[model samples]
Target: MYQRRTAVRRRKSRLPSYAFVLAVVSFMLAFAFPPEQPDEPSARTLPVRSLSAAACSVPPPVSQGAEPSIPSSDGEDGWMLTLVNPWNPLPEDYACTLTRLSSGHSVDERCYPDLQAMMDACRAAGLKPVICSSYRSREKQEELFQNKVNRLIAQGYSQERAKAEAAKSVALPGTSEHQLGLAVDIVDLSNQNLDSTQETTAVQQWLMAHSWEYGFILRYPNDKSDLTGIIYEPWHYRYVGKDAAAEIYRQGLCLEEYLEQTA
Candidate 1:
């Protein structure tokens, strides 16, 4: 009887110890191998669902100052923005002080410094930029216009047709920008011809890219010919002052477009 009772007591004691060991093993296993958690998103790996929602949302309104303000045309630099075209001829009272260049060409004295700096920069950059034509008297303009008309007539165009065609290529004497002394025909020394081919020259490429830095802009662009009322003459550049030039360049605007916006 005594042996049986001792055996029962020993069995009960082992039961409690066994339970304790089982609990400890479970705790240790939990610490060693924790349950998996969901992954967090990074900026680059944002959830697709969230991204879709964002993409569908309405865009924020543009700020008031988002677009650049057009410069004032009535400011002290008003003369720099003078508009000369077929319709707007040079005023009878218009006059500018002339500054002659080494090549016997002249530009407006007001724009001389910028013009000189532009040419200096071009030469410094290993370019051979030449001012082939600059300021022209009314008589010179008339002669050039007549020469164009004569050439067209020789090509079998009627006198009336030739006159109209010539005016398109060469501005009518009174309406020529050359008379204002703010425009110049710059050409690469390698190719002195004034045509679309000039756009391909190194000197022209440089001027097109950087002329605004020196207060000039390509006077006529190929696509803007309708608005400018002149064919694309890539060699021709006009002084509009640095402020207007920079804005015009940034906006991909021709001189007429820039003036219209400010007006």
Candidate 2:
């Protein structure tokens, strides 16, 4: 009877040992091979989040005495941010008070002072900044565009090809910024060609670097032709006011992009 009782006790003790061994092994296995964890989000997602946040954030108000808020087309201050492009044509009857340059090219009266100042500054720096072209009526713009297209066709291009190629240099009629009276085509007086080579002239170089100080920007920069939908025209400049010009310069943004971003 005693032997039977001892055997039972020994068996019970062995069961506890087996249970403890299994518990220990399970604990060790958990540490050795843990459950898989999900991957963290990628860094590429940061910009999207930031952009989303920025989209929802309100832009700070312009300071007192700073350039006035950009206005709609009907407002007196509308011309400052007016956009003219193939996709955005000028309205019929769109007009501005114009002041004529010595070259007989006219610009918006509001921008005349800055234009004169820019030219005077250029002269003071021993550079001759000639105003080759400025504001144009729709008729004049049509004539210019047609002339360019005709010349391209004469060069053996098809009518469709000529129109497309000509448009890179001459905006179609109402789409021209010149019609807005805020654009100017300037060239070195000594080198009076509106070609890509104009960018190498001292006057052109100076204007590109400093025109923003006078509210002008290289309207069709070589790098931004894709965005501007125009060929690189180093001789062309546009007046967008000091504040807008400064921001555009700082951001390295084309006028179209700037207007879009601000809008």
Candidate 3:
């Protein structure tokens, strides 16, 4: 008569096998799923798009951001606008050609150290540029502006219209680029003439196309009238340093836009 008694086994049953199973499960998860990234936000975070070209080729649409405060009337907006649309190279900060049309039209000797160098470059490059206009005081601008207003009025323009028209080319004293003595109008100096070819001449053309090399720019271009607030002056070149001019010309951005970003 044998009594059947069940004894519990105390021996460890395959500890390594349990560990191997856990390792397999971990490996499967590692292959099937990716670990979280540091840059990625948590579940509660709102997703954000990256700014790289792959994510957004163009800038986010404007007018969606908080609006800038409206500036006051006394050039408050003018400052914001001017800051937003700065006139680069401010006057005479950059070296450029200063031509003398008459006896009184010479640049201060210091303001023209590069004249000889510029002349040498022109001669070496076979560029014959004649100086057309030069330094004008604030009084001169007033005089010139009045003259333009008078002439326009004589041509059947209303007084208001004449004044506005004259304002374009003749800056209201102290605001003229020429006053800084760093601007000039150059053209083919052949026959010692002042008038440039309406289109850039071979000489002027080359100069305009490569003016940045000498720290100059065409000053005004048709495409940037709204920004420049001046008519295109293909012959006009203002010295703004080689790097700045190169950047300006290369980017094809107007002085206003150029100044804005820089400021």
RMSD of each: 28.8, 23.0, 25.1
Tens-digit per-residue lDDT, 1-263, candidate 3: 11121112122223355588877777788688765434332233111111221211232233434543322112212221211011222232223234553435655233355544665677688767676766666567568779989999999999988877766665555456665565666667653343334444666767767677766677777787655656676776776655556777887865554553343
lDDT of 2 by residue, 123-181 (tens): 99999888888999989999999999999999999999999888878898877989888
Q: What is the C-alpha lDDT of each candidate?
A: 0.76, 0.74, 0.53
Each candidate's number of clashing pairs is 0, 0, 0
Against the hidden reference, what TM-scores do the models get?
0.73, 0.71, 0.57
lDDT of 1 by residue, 127-228 (tens): 999999999988899899999999999999999999888877799887788988899999999999988899999999999999999999999899876667
Model 3 lDDT on a 0 to 1 scale: 0.53
- Colliding pairs, model 3: none
Clashes of 2: 0
TM-score of 1: 0.73
Could you tell me which 10 consecutive residues in candidate 2 have the lowest summed lDDT? 1-10
Q: Which stretches of candidate 2 lie over 4 Å from their true place?
A: 1-76
